[model samples]
Each structure stands twice: as structure tokens, then as C-alpha cells.
Target: MSVHRSALCRGPYGGEGAAAGGTGCSDPAIFEVARHGRPPLPVCPVHLGPALLMASGVLWPPEIRLIGRVTGLRP
Candidate 1:
């Protein structure tokens, strides 16, 4: 599913009366993400960091220790 031109962020937001399982964030999307055979989805800058971090963790497991070195983290 390609993201529409006016797509909003698909990140999770915390609040009451939010969509059944959706984030209440109505921020405009700044990026399009496609992963694991999934269609592209829109994402806003505010939520992009966490998405990228999660992707990194999945792509590079902690046991590898390469992520920390590459990112300049002490871990």
C-alpha cells in the first residue's frame, strides 16, 4: 500500500479516546517506510527516530556489538 500524498504519521501515540490501536498524532508524514514485505507507510519526523532505532535493533542484534561501535555508543 503506497502512502498517499497527504498521509499522516503512523507512529504510536499515548492518550485517551485515541483510535482503537492507532496513535492520535496527526503530524504530516516526512518519510515513507517499507519493510519485511510490507507496503510503504508514512511517518513523521517526531516518530522517525524510534522507528529507525527499532529497525536497527532488529537488523543488528545487541550481541553483534557492531551498532554501538558504528554509532559511537559506549555499549
Candidate 2:
């Protein structure tokens, strides 16, 4: 038998959250793949709750981009 190791939530934002010692919240629920990478977290930034970044087969990039443009955030 073989077992695969899944990723973990760094934090609400990404690795920084993890580095900051954030354990992440349980609102929208974390998925196997969602935790594997950084950014596009499975939680709401406002409430620090779980949420899906995608909606109706479309990704919510505009909002993220806007944040980056305004804050000059790379990730």
C-alpha cells in the first residue's frame, strides 16, 4: 500500500501566515490541493474564514490583482 502526503495551510495569506505561526481557520474548509500551494487561500481575508476563491468556473483574479496593484504585494 502507498500513501501520499498532502499540503498544509500556511495561513490566511500564504507562507507568511504560516511563518507568523498562523494555524489557519476552518470556515470554508480546506481542500487537499488548496493547501499544497501558496496564495488563493481557502479562507476569507475579512473574516479569516474558509471560502472558495473560484466562483462559477471563473477565478477571482481581478480582486486579487487589485490588491496587488494597490499594496504592491508580490504574493
Candidate 3:
């Protein structure tokens, strides 16, 4: 069964939530995603960046679906 737990934000501009009730963002302590064999990892939407933003490539057409297959993550 899947578990629910708070996760710390891993964004580049994260880690300002533990200030003992200070006036700062709470780092969006959200749930985690873990596979049965893999360990739990924090997923911050802020740092994920655009879903498709190829910087420099030389291909007729980028296979975007391949990413989901390789990483087992849904688009």
C-alpha cells in the first residue's frame, strides 16, 4: 500500500520553512511517491521546470513519450 508523508521542497530556492514560526514560506511540505523496490523521494513541482524544453538538439522529432517509459513517470 502507498503511504502518505510530508516532504520537504527540493527547489533551488527552497529550505526556508523551518524558521520556528517565522514569516517565511513553509516549503510546501507535501506527500511523497515511492515504489515498492525504490526508496521514497521528494518531488517539488517548482524545480521540475517545463515538461518539454529542449535546449540544443539535432533530431527530426524528439521522442517525448520515451521519457515516461524510461522513468516510469506519467506525463
The lDDT leader among the candidates is 1
Which residue pairs show backbone clashes in model 2?
28-50
User: lDDT-based ranking, best first?
Assistant: 1, 2, 3
- Candidate of highest TM-score: 1
What's the lDDT for residue 41 in model 1? 41
Q: Which stretches of candidate 1 lie over 4 Å from their true place?
A: 1-3, 12-21, 55-75
* Residue-level lDDT tens digits of model 1 in 1-75: 233546666643321235422365676666654444343444566665565454322222212111111122385
Candidate 3 has what TM-score? 0.24
In model 3, pairs of residues that clash are none
Better of 1 and 3 by TM-score: 1
Q: Order the candidates by TM-score, highest first — what do you get?
A: 1, 3, 2
The per-residue C-alpha lDDT of model 1 at residue 39 equals 39
Give a tens-digit lDDT track for model 2, residues 1-75: 012112333334343433532345432322322332344432224323322332222233322311111123476
Give stretches of model 2 more than 4 Å off: 1-5, 16-29, 32-75
lDDT for 37 in candidate 2 is 31
What's the lDDT for all of these models? 0.44, 0.31, 0.29
